[model samples]
Target chain A: MAASATRADALVHARGLTKRFDKLVAVDAIDFDVQRGEAFGFLGPNGAGKTSTMRMIGCVSSPSGGELRVLGLDPVIDGPRIRARLGVVPQADTLDMELRVDENLLTYARYFDIPRDVARARTQELLEFVQLKDRAKDEVEPLSGGMKRRLTIARALVNEPGLLLLDEPTTGLDPQARHLVWDRLYRLKQQGVTIVLTTHYMDEAEQLCDRLVVMDKAKIVASGSPRSLIDQYSTREVLELRFPIDAAPALDGKLDGIAERVEVLPDRVLLYAHDGEAAASAVHQRGLRPESTLVRRSTLEDVFLRLTGRSLIE
Target chain B: MTGALRVVEHHLMVYRRTWKGGMFVSFASPILFLAAIGIGLGSLIARGPVHTVGGVSYLTFLAPGLLAATAMQTAFVETTYPVMAKIQWLRTYDGMLATPLTVRDVLGGEIGWLVIRLATTAFAFFLVMVLFGTVHSLVALLMIPVVVLNGLAFGAPIFAFTATQRKDKGFPTIGRFIITPLFLLGGVFFPIAQLPPIAQGIAWATPLAHSVVLSRSLAIGGMNPSALIDVAVLAAYATLGIIAASITLPRRLVR
Candidate 1:
């Protein structure tokens, strides 16, 4: 992992940004600053207003209230100017399926008023960059999900944008496909491109994000680095214990002092502790035998559950 | 301006790729209408003495209206479904908006492309009319520009309407309740003067009515001062429609 420099100059700055749909507030007043040459993330589950916020930054959707600046230009008065320097990959793939893969890139390039010859050259380079050179002449419909995503990324890069906004970049891909996309994004970040991404996948957020905000119900509940957030909201380790229905009650208060916190779920109980082995010893010392016991490091998922009181998947 | 031109170019590229399908549909519709209505239905109207305004057959009088009507229909269909697809189904405009092209540029390009498509279809219809002996004098050739203007006038409002649409159910409703009625009453197959006075007044409000009246006048080599008025009305609609689309399209996408 490349070390990211901490700076105060923001490439994207939002002050009390909010969006409303009818009476439903999609994105409440939230403020954040994304600096140059850093990968920022909006880490949230579905319906948390991540996509809405990204759209506002992308200049495709208007913010209902608050101030927003992209590349130091106001999104309302200077939308065209800001959009000229920004690239967006929406949550759903909106590729022009009617055109060939190469034609799609070339057509998008033309929208930026790129000359035909220049567009042609850029299309070739982008095709090779996405590893879709052999499929340049093929229709977009037959390409796999991963290829379509790569093409979308390539299309977003056609104008050589300064900031890239990706909404759920790896939402519905296979494991291998997700890694391929992650690798590609990592390379772009290495080249000093500023990336702002929204993802529900905890691993994706951990792997790509330098700093992130955890949004719930249209508001930012927490914001910090992954490691800092984990340390703030969770212990160093978590021990999971699953017992038979009858034996569960005997172990309820037997290991209270063994951990920092204990959560009793319907099916299982979790012990958040600084040391998992000591917690397990305490549990066994109380003569409570369980069906299964496992000790593992705490993750972002635990932090999300701890803060939101709902599992990310649920 | 260059960005708008690029949008126009992209539309042309798409048209080229799908030209065969487009030609088959656009060309076949008018020929089928000409055959089904003019030839098939004309035989039943009793060999009424050929109405000669400028030494042309009654069929010639009917020709220009059909040409203009066909152009309008082609433009309407082209802008309606495709515009809806770009706004809703395909989301092509959203992708384009990420570039330097403003929403005004997109609207300008789309309307411009509609005019070009209308021209191509009007040319095909004009040739078919000539083959059927319905064209008289060299003045009929001038109907091309007139038909294109007619198309823009009819298509502009439809494009604006489609941009505001969130669903497709109302599309057929508009086509059936509005467009089909205009087609039947706008003097496409017969003279509007032959209708009742109240019906003529209603047809006068329609853009197609102005187009048919002007096209027929040009096709028969008879120039009426009111023809220029009709042209001006169609032009006004085109200009206002383009402006309205430019203003409304951005709100639609950005909101």
Candidate 2:
């Protein structure tokens, strides 16, 4: 009966899902679907309702209105059953500071009623998977931030959940640490685990998410594959020009005909075109002597800015 | 129910990692109090006109009072800073809820662990009383249950209160204002009969005072039917605390 109530093809199905806190609306009416074995994401800046939506899907926070079904079970009614099969990594590291790293996973496995011997075996394998095998006996307090994040990921996998939900999986890590986490998540996806993550990093979304929704101000402005979203909202390449002062807006009129769309930011002027080199040459021909110019391929950042008129990171 | 037991297992693991200092503090504090106040003051009181309290030595009278007080203090302490850490700073409860456990299971498991702590601490204190020649009858073993009830009467309410707190600022206030006052004046050091009538009435209303009365009666082999009323009061307090925790903990954790 629960399966009959939801779309059986998708692991998560939300229709006009909303979350309200008193008078403030954290997540407005929005809709999306997450297919199994795919890496789906909610890409937005801070205060863009990404965490709220993830919490709703994680069954930690109840939605204020509309419909939400996770793993074909209603979150409000079948929360514990749904949660038993779902893994969640919150925005903050909630690891036990007093216990050793391995104990963290072992105790969490008990919450799911996993037997002791099996839990121990899984703990060893998860620590090895997260590259924290050496630190299994070490207390969690002194480990680095990246190590803590990886341990948290390992803890989430102790139950062998089918759907993994990570809220801001790599928000506060160095480039090396971010790549390490992404590598682990990619392996999980390959093993047929459906991954749902929320992040503000456009590069993270591009690298890990097979498909994503662009959320801004409590609503999803766009949703598609990364390449398709970029193609629909942005050009193939972008020409960036910077000036000492805020002169990009003044030169927006002159930079018009060279690119498909011209975006004049406070510090830099962006020209979206198929040939960034040609656009840069056209800017030189217009006698606009800028301090610097660079050409790069269009990224999800370009698509976000084009859709929301704001950068992905504030 | 199994989910709640899992929470108990989690706390046991936490206790296993840091049990040395905690065990020493729990066992040593009651013995230290018995030595300093029970024996030290019992000697001076023996020299006075009223040498015995309730037809026994002062040390005997004070031993059961301290037993009940130890239960109350241990319960209050366990539910305050530790509960606050699990709610806010450490986020252990959030981590638990992310699993198959519900808010009820988490809170139930926490109170269950509190009961275990109360039982162990009470039994240890009761042993010290026996070594001191304080137990006068076979019914003295029943003090363990009375002591545990006294603990839940305090631990449950404090656990509920701690769940609703956003910061730990109010914790010290509860310790200073409510717990300290009850420890000092609620039939611990001296009989509430020595106080004025109004003070006696207030003391009788407190769970510690009832537990102290029941514990003293059991230790001295006095079979008073009024002990049933004392049991009812302690039971009511424990039940009410569980109810309040059920209401507040979910609001804090599942939001």
Q: Predicted chain A of model 2: TM-score relative to the true chain A?
A: 0.96
Model 1 chain A: worst 10 consecutive residues (lDDT sum): A1-10
Please give, for residues A1-314, the per-residue lDDT of candidate 1 as tens digits. 22342223688888799999999999999988898888999988899999999989988788999988888888888888888888889888889988999999989988877788999999999899888999999999999999999999999999888799999998889999899899989989998899999998889999999999999999999988889899999999999999898877777468778789888877888999999988998888988787889999988888888999877766
Q: Give the per-residue lDDT digits (tens) of candidate 2, residues A1-314.
A: 12243377789999999999999999999998888888999999999999999989989899999999999999999999999999999999899998899999999999999999999999999999999999999999999889999999999999999999999998899899999999999999999999999999989999999999999999999998899999999999999998769555567478769999888887888989999999999999999989999999999999999988999888
lDDT of 1 at A39: 92
* Number of the top lDDT candidate: 2
Which candidate has the highest DockQ of all? 2
TM-score of each: 0.92, 0.97
Interface RMSD, candidates in the order listed: 1.2, 0.7
- In the predicted model 2, the residue pairs found to clash are none
* Deviation in Å, model 1, residue B28 alpha carbon: 3.6
- Residue-level lDDT tens digits of model 1 in B1-255: 777787898897787799998788766876787787767666655365653433444466567888887877777787788899998898988888877887888887888788889888888888888778777778888889998998998888778878888898777887897778878878887778889999999888778899898888887676777987898888988887877777777779877
Considering chain A alone, what is the TM-score of candidate 1? Answer: 0.93
Q: What digit string (tens of lDDT, one per residue) describes model 2 on residues B1-255? A: 999899999989999978788778777887888899889999999999999887888889899989999999999889999999998998888888888899989988999999999998898888888888899989999999998999999999999999999988998898898889888988888889998899889889889999998999999988557899999999999999999999999988877
